[model samples]
Target: MKKYILDLPEFILVALSAYWFLENYIGTNHFNPYAFIVFAMLLLQIYFKNKYVGFLLAWFISLFSLYMVLAVISEFRDFPTLISEGALKLLAFGLGFCFLAMGSAVLMFYKYFPKVFPARF
Candidate 1:
């Protein structure tokens, strides 16, 4: 298995980016979790077991995370009382935990299962 920690920064950034973009553009209070899951699957299928693919996912995740943080910050500043603290906390927890788990799994596979993440042309 590859070390998913390797993709931490990217995951945070991408996930946050997606979160913020969605919030700002859609004016929504929650992230559509299904959308990110679909993205994850697409990345896996399209990349076809390349290390660079991992990097790409990481970058995307980072963008997403950046968005999320921005949204929370903006909301907190404008209407702290209007914001549901639980929602923010839950989103952070879910995003951080799940993304790390998925990223780590990918890294672990590459680390141990070289056949899966084979050196390529």
Candidate 2:
């Protein structure tokens, strides 16, 4: 369905972000199964009918995206040059994605979702 184009990839990114954040932030020594659980559930979240859950999920995505923006900058700040081709490309991609994810989250907050999944919570 047309809706999948937006929702599928959006949640996929959410899952990846969640997984990466947990893995990196918490460290391997303190590994836990929660991240994997989150990744799996997010992948299945193609549709959301509950206003509260949708709002919460979108909020999470937006916050995580902001965190990603900071992470990207901090992770790359020590590079030899900020404008090197690779670095520039990465920065652009990172910013663009965060902008898009946050925008989608806003849309969800405003009840503009495309009905990508069944009722959840």
Candidate 3:
């Protein structure tokens, strides 16, 4: 059960990646580049069963989360616009923070358990 809990982040990432791919396919009728990377990471994780794979996935998510934080902060300069948007902006901000927190937790796990997340190269 503890091991399953530790693997939860990877599972969440895989589910989110699949949803994003489907959303882009159905809604935009185009391929999303990030979806390819997500799929690759998922496959690699399954093949290797290594914590390093999870770290890589978390790193990718963290980068995106950081970008989202920057984008939201820039939008904040137009505070009135955000207010006019109502709950949508708030919801996005909340999700961004959640992603940031999850990313940080994954990184800390790798940092503290270096032997568990050995470098493949």
Best prediction by lDDT: 2
Quote each prediction's TM-score: 0.38, 0.58, 0.66
lDDT of 3 by residue, 1-121 (tens): 8777666656666676777788898899998988867777776775677666555556667677677666666666556665566546665765666574466546535643565645789
lDDT of 1 by residue, 2-76 (tens): 445544434554564456457654785656665666456444633464555555554454455466656655645
lDDT of 2 by residue, 27-104 (tens): 765655655655554554554445556656777878977897898888668679887988888888878767777776
- The alpha-carbon deviation from the true structure for residue 24 of candidate 1, after best TM-score superposition, in angstroms, is 16
TM-score of 1: 0.38
Instruction: List per-prediction Cα lDDT, in the order shown.
Output: 0.53, 0.65, 0.65
Better of 2 and 3 by lDDT: 2
How far residue 66's Cα lies from its native spot in candidate 1, in Å, is 1.4
Pick by TM-score: 1 or 3, better one: 3
RMSD of each: 8.5, 6.4, 4.5
Worst lDDT 10-window in candidate 2 = 109-118
Error of 2 at 15 (Å): 9.5
RMSD after Cα superposition, model 1: 8.5
Model 2 compared with the native: what TM-score? 0.58
Candidate 3: worst-modelled 10 consecutive residues by lDDT:
104-113
Best by TM-score: 3
